[model samples]
Target chain A: MSEDRIDIGGIADEYVLGLLDAIEARQVETDMESDPDLKAAIAASRDRFLPLDDTAEPTVIGDDLWTRIDAALPVQGAAPIDVSRLTANDNRPGGWRATALAAMAAAVILAVALSVNLMRTIEPLVVAVLVNEAGDIQAIVEDFGNEKAAVRLLADFTVPQGKTIEVWTLPSPERGPVSLGLIDDARSVRLDGPALPKPHDSQLYELTLEQAGGSPTGRPTGLILAKGFAKITR
Target chain B: MVTGAAPDDLTTALAACAKGDRTALRGIFDREAGRLVTIAERIVRRRDLAEEVVQESFIRIWTQAHQYQPDRGSARGWIYAIVRNRALNLLRDSKREYTVEDVELLRERDQVDHVMAAWHRLDRTSRLHDCLGALDDTKRRGILMAYIGGYSHGEIAGRLSIPLGTTKSWIRRGLSALRECMA
Candidate 1:
């Protein structure tokens, strides 16, 4: 990254052209503060195509588009979640609250190696976009609850690093994946049937290289540092 | 310093938004919805996905406006960044159809009206567009596709049908030239 080898001039061009590498783009961002010249260049290049932004024709979206969106919105005027009756204790957890709690429990298991592989002998199981590092989502973690996981994971573990595992119980492993939560690093973790089922019966629990924020995919589209089964807890 | 509203005006609006002012939020939305949608559509070509990206972007903006630190960047850049990042993710994560699909995208003849309207705005768009105009037509188009269409380097290359390396070089050099020119 020496100034000599790292050509700010070249990078600026690529960046404006939107063809710069991740590392190069990041470098430009860092250098921009001290390098006034670089900043000016970026602004100019950005302008070149700013107007083409609305290049697409005005899509005559069927009423359903807005209606669907409106319907999906958090009914802003819808009862306001009955806040009056909701005391700290009576706070009815949203559906996700339970899953988040379940994830925490799963995380705890990940921390301490107590494989629930045996649980697969029991009932069935279940499954956001995420970025790689550029702050964009790489994949999604599908949720499966009502379907009662139709799949199972049947594998043992042995990772190099105490890898953090994330289990994705996707509706269709063929499609995108869902992130249930994280598992402890280089350790064994199990999911129960009453628990979340892995996306496919042969769902994947992979160890990804993540910073604190976790992978954007909600699943590990990162280096498959290690992988194992979607076993159940007997 | 003199206009309908100063730069500070945008910041003030954001502050109000941060205070949970739904009205202020709407104002921000009203002002930027078209732009946001355009930006979102740029990144996520699919209209449905683009709309989703725009909606999510607004939700994030509403919730995260309080996190805005003008010192880092302007309210506008930060806002656009959110949508940009979201759109980028949508494009990369979800395998979208790269080619023109549906009659809507291919029915290009009619889109000229919309495109022209945007073009007229661009021609008149403040000092920024002037800076962009300084770039060569090819370089400008490449940059525009990226910024507006949300086309990745690869996509840009595909559309432009040029060597990937050349496209990358154009973007890099274009940015540098722009910064220099604008400065």
Candidate 2:
């Protein structure tokens, strides 16, 4: 890294200490990605200054704040299947029978509605939920057999005034993630599938906040707001 | 009194959060939300904006929990880093007018001194405490004002009535010395 000629340790310390200006901080972030030494220095400085956090007095959180945060979480089934909840299904008490029955009824109705309305044209073999850094489900991807994938937004997302959200995929075993395309909003869009391998189970799909148009480098060149792995349901 | 989860527990809770356990996240929130809000408030200087920063920080924590590597630092530190980064980003983006009346500026300096004194009382034994204690008042306050208050170099210089370059140099030198002393 060209920054090697500079004092990375001092820069990392200042960056972690929040002394760098916004523009300088952003530059450091960009540099850290390619400069392993700079990244390590940053990690070290973070640990060094960590104890100072103990100084702040705890300010009581408003009761409604958690409620707001909870509401923003990506709804279940929008991403990879949660592996932890999969086990211990048969051990629930008999009191859960009523809840189970109601859930099953709702699932059946929803399945029929989805098949009739959203999936009528293309059968989804694998579904992936793409979440932003906030864990908000920003988009959902349905892989129809072949290299084609249909992506739909789960929430109304406004592309920041001057920026666009770029989609990327890290196909299994690939050394680098490849760009899918640029999305303007939370609207359904078809990805014609880049020249990379077909989308497969366990592959990661991510949405990054990037400058308008897209990453000029043909790669993700911004903050990743959400990402999740593909899970084959069929 | 704010009682944090032990570093190990926080790490485990974050790991569980990465697994999509909402309750684990709530457990973390129940523990650190107050301290996080207070820190954000110190930086952003508005209760509502601080709350917004805390809310957004938790969401970022939940989504990026899987990316937290324990070997690098404490989970609590990682969480605070995210919160501080979010708060600072908001402060920078808002570009709020920084017109401080003379009286208001004096009041803020006193407030910072009060908080710094409180910190000294609570954390007397930490290596950072010792290293920071060793610095002169200007260097120490410059570093604290930047890290704790999220003041930019210009802001710190303005607050301290010093040249901007001097403020920057003091903070950089302070951090470098702190690192060396702690090491």
Candidate 3:
């Protein structure tokens, strides 16, 4: 770590504070990213200043705050951006933005539809929900590696900040929900069961939002988000 | 819905946003808005302009979320860079050139900024006040301006009415001193 022997500790401090010129600043950023030891040192120095940014404690983002933010946010799922705000400034050439966004949205929608459609058609391993009046949804999974099948469902509720939703595969109608790892929005984690259970009625794939990181006690702390029947649509 | 993408799931979530997952996009916003807004406010120092920066950052994130790769820095760092760059440009554009009066105002504002900044989680300075108190007045001020306010060497020189080279050395030595003392 002779490369780390430079007594330029002061320069690292200056760099973190944005005291360096653009060139020097970029150089430091590059070094920080490329050099792990240097990065660790800078982080140690920078930690001294962390409290400066910690003014707002992790306050419970109000329920209403989410609503307000949601109202202000762009609509989801390939929805075309509503760029009505830019139009009022008829002074500058802002029309290009909306046009560009519309083009992008069009492209993405085409991609998603293709993916969703293909997934449906291929029907690799299918699962369907048979939800009923009692608010129960049984997950019918089909075609795992062999005759085995796995069932999974994402809960349709808040997972709370720093928490994950666990999808449980109940062995029998009266049995407890089996553990399926935490659900992150990264990708749908489809939990596979052992051998295919006799495809019967009322086999549920349920999800409950648990506490920070996840339910420590192996149970739901937040609330049930989604419950669906594993109706494997071949 | 969130506006910005999550750090760990940037690429996937960005892909999802492109796929029209409004909820996914909103998830990004809900996570990082507060930090981004603070960065914007620090750069612009004006509410409306900071808002403009935040709005622009959101729009840019909406479009560029697709290009974000996990191998790069981080979702948070990337979004912050975008927001900070926007805020800086906006600050530069509005011709808010720091004048003598602005300097005085900035100095007065530093106390409150210093107080509130210490409350933040950025970790620029931890136990800094104690380290600062240990230093001489000149060295303490140097650390304060550089770390607390993110001031450039030239600006610090101008504020203290000292030669640029001298200010630079002070900052360099002061940081070293603080490190030694803290260690």
Candidate 4:
């Protein structure tokens, strides 16, 4: 669709004004994914109304609020590990038995340290936030550097009587859409996909409503309920 | 808006947070939590719920910091968008009603005062101030009521004693005029 064809009858303004109901708002968001002009309009509207946000006087927050937020934060591999205890026993010297025990303990500590380093280094090669046609976030796809990817559903999706939601990714133009796996229901699950190539940034990932068994054509053959472009997660 | 921290600082802080720097997230909280709480409170109208919104918003900022595109919008705007969206969602889900209690009535009246106060606070030398100043009194009030107080169309009509359809048109035309004037 052409940008000029979009009706600019202050729909963006209504959206920013909180006048649109939940469903209408979601439809606007969904349309925005494919319409740059609409997205720009909404962004402009938000920018224009931002000054009103400043009119609010800063409300004093309870001290416990920050503590609660901190506690709820996801583990981002920055957790502190007390290494002092590991070195505390180093200064002690004894017989061969003590030396062997110390060596064993040192090995265990080294293994733990390596695993932590691995955890720090290993992250999803790319991430995608899948949104349904209504623009509501439905699921998230995380493609590891290997032939493994994880799909976590953010919202419940109703599967039809004989339909299943199949996850697909386009590794390259030559290799159209490849099936990662079939989702039985709306739940977080990992897919052991066929080895093709490493998922690149902006790679397409989608969930299509297909037959209960799976797509017979080994490609996306049904309605694409949710889709998103992958973002490189460094 | 005059942020205590510069816009560049917020952008840089977001980048740092994306790199797993917890202290950077803390820096954002220290600078913007109070104002964020206030914004959420305006929409949700409850201290505890507003605080919850801010907390959830900060968490989103932490997790989705990587998604922030510098070319798209200001970091401060992005942060405010998160807070507003969360607060709006909460308000929508709860489907709050405006009661006729004395305190409720007092708060409704204050919404008008808050909106006008914001208009008055806008820098006179700025284009936004000039554009908004150019709007009709009722039209401008309708726009402000929605943006600042998060009032729905029906609520604005009820408060302003106008028909719902009129309220919608006033706001729609008011926004269109504001955009053209600013442009």
Most lDDT-accurate candidate: 4
Q: Which stretches of candidate 1 lie over 4 Å from their true place?
A: A1-234, B1-6, B96-121, B124-135
Note the DockQ of each predicted structure: 0.15, 0.20, 0.12, 0.18
| Candidate 4: true interface contacts recovered | 0.47
TM-score of chain B of 4: 0.88
Q: What are the C-alpha RMSDs, in order, of all predicted structures?
A: 13.8, 17.6, 21.8, 21.7
* TM-score, B chain alone, candidates in order: 0.75, 0.87, 0.63, 0.88
Tens digit of per-residue lDDT, candidate 3, span A49-134: 44443443332332433443343444433334334333222112222222332333343333333334434544433343422112
The clash numbers for all candidates, in the given order, read 54, 6, 47, 0
User: Could you give the CAPRI-style class of model 2?
Assistant: incorrect
Which model, 1 or 2, shows the larger DockQ? Answer: 2
Best by TM-score: 2
Worst 10 residues of 2 chain A by lDDT: A87-96
Q: Please, what are the lDDT tens digits per residue for candidate 4 over residues B1-183?
A: 555678899999999988888899999998889999888877766665577678767777876787677543678887898788777776664342111342244346466666677778766676777888899888888887787777889888988899999998888778878888876
Model 2 stretches astray by more than 4 angstroms? A1-6, A75-234, B1-3, B96-111
Q: Which 10 residues in a row give candidate 4 chain B its minimum summed lDDT?
A: B94-103
Measured against the true structure, the TM-scores of the candidates, in listed sequence, are 0.49, 0.59, 0.42, 0.58
